[model samples]
Target: MSTSTAAAPVVADERVASKGPVAKLLGRPEIGALVGAIALFVFFAVVAPVFLQPSSIATVLYGASTIGIMAVGVSLLMIGGEFDLSTGVAVISSALTASLFSWYFSTNMWVGVVLALAVSLAIGFVNGWILIKTKLPSFIVTLATFLMLTGLNLGLTRLIGGSVSSPSTSTMDGFASAKAVFASSVNLAGVDVNITVFIWIALVAVASWILLRTRVGNWIFAVGGDANAARAVGVPVVRTKIGLFMGVGFCGWILGMHNLFAFATVQSGEGIGNEFLYIIAAVIGGCLLTGGYGSAVGGAIGAFIFGMANKGIVYAEWNPDWFKFFLGLMLLLATIVNLVVKKRAEAK
Candidate 1:
């Protein structure tokens, strides 16, 4: 009887397997990003001679690590049907907060790190709370938080250091643990890769597993697909959204830590403009701007593309100023392609 029951299930699975390649591909959103990344690699490899170099590849991956870290979190939050504009500003805010604590109080580096994360989480809670409580769009709520955090980051930095850029000496004197975590790099294939690479990779792996293998992942998709409908079905929509917000905030805090490790001095304005880049990378990697359809790995791949373009252009001796033009073109092309692909998917 058990064998017969198992045989019946196998027959049902065989029926689904016969649905065709398009069905299988549609069932897995990650395939789109993978295909896109491969295509881009082929394009660059064929046309840009420098792109194939080991050094060039290392540069791309290294640059991608920082933004990719945040992209993973934003992708998860986007999948849950929300956005956080304050991400970039929060980076600076956290860094400066950490700097202030370690520099002035002579506190333990880990304590300052904890305090920075807590501050970021508090901001995230406020963002989610205001949105849920007031029935406002998350975009509006987060935009306000973004602007406020930007101001706070600059204002606080100046108040502390009397300038926008905090000096390096202050950081070195105070944060020993921060230095060990953020500044260390591992040598790989003659390339000095930051330790943050492992962190980003780990985050992507964990996020992908959670999304594909866990019950919480199911709830994330359901919430993003339709919050009201999900709530009606007993999904904890509010709690889910709040969790996503906290995830974003935590990502921002990690970014600050990574940046501090990379550059000992904290710059108030360094990360303020990165908000759009994270969104663009996520969108290009297969996350829908409209929400509910994207993978964490896609976001990482998107960051890889950005990093490749940035470093490849410079390595190939192209003008750095052209980066802005390239970014605009990329944004336009990716959006158009995504729309076309989305239409075809919907039509089918």
Candidate 2:
């Protein structure tokens, strides 16, 4: 009897030992993001002495804020097992919405803001409705939406301004508040830091809260982990997914409003090709392409890395063309490492 009890205890210990490595790997998904950020910073700082300058750092933070905001939203949706390809066009459309309202109607800035957000949420619902109802892959559904919105953005900008290349915001009224929220700078330790940075910070805080502290965050994790199981357990998987899609659109709109207010002008084609960048940032932040796990903070860090590399290279007097090459390398490396780690974790 004593021998039988001893054997059972040993078996339990073996099971735990087998899971130890896997547990370690899954401890914190953001570990890779931290390591990548540090590694890149060290590499760039060593190779380019100007990489750590105060102004250079500020520029990196500012340039990354808009995309960082979008990436955070994408990370959330990815965590819930969905994707939004229309984010790029959504960004332009949101900005254009605000721009047109302010430009033509002399509408209240607040009204333009409301309209931009509402339009994005409406589009998100449409995307969700199509994907959930048809049981179609979100990738294909959003891709179609992406093309459609792109065409509309371009056509409407031309219709409004009579020219695509020089989209004008001069006629936009109540530009002051928009600038204060999106473009205006506050003196931070003697540095002129754009309000967009604050927006990024606020977004991170809110996203982290929603993802970590709220029940909705748990649903996001569960829905991504296993949608069928989540639904069986009473989770509203479709609604949750639709909400995430809307989050992406909202992020895009915020960025659009920021641009419209900051420059008081925007290219009709602006934000085109930017959707991929947001995805890249989210992936680098440790959001799995296949979904289930991600970090809002990781997304922010990823954005910082991209922003730093883009501006840091320029400040260091390096060829701007090298930026694309560097970005490609970063994405490839992150993907490879993430895959290896994911496989190892699953192996147990």
CA lDDT scores, all candidates in order: 0.80, 0.82
Candidate 1: the clashing residue pairs are none
lDDT winner: 2
lDDT of 1 by residue, 184-272 (tens): 77888787777777888998999899888998788888888888898998988888888888888888888888777567778888776
lDDT score at residue 272, model 2, on the 0-100 scale: 72
| Residue 335 in model 1: lDDT | 61
TM-score of candidate 2 against the unseen true structure: 0.89
* TM-scores vs. true structure, each candidate: 0.90, 0.89
How displaced is residue 29 in candidate 1, in Å?
Answer: 2.5
Error of 1 at 66 (Å): 1.2
lDDT (tens digit, per residue) of candidate 2 on 66-157:
78989989999999988888888888888888777656676776687789889988888889889899989989999999999888878887
Off by over 4 Å in 2: 1-26, 165-167, 170-172, 342-348
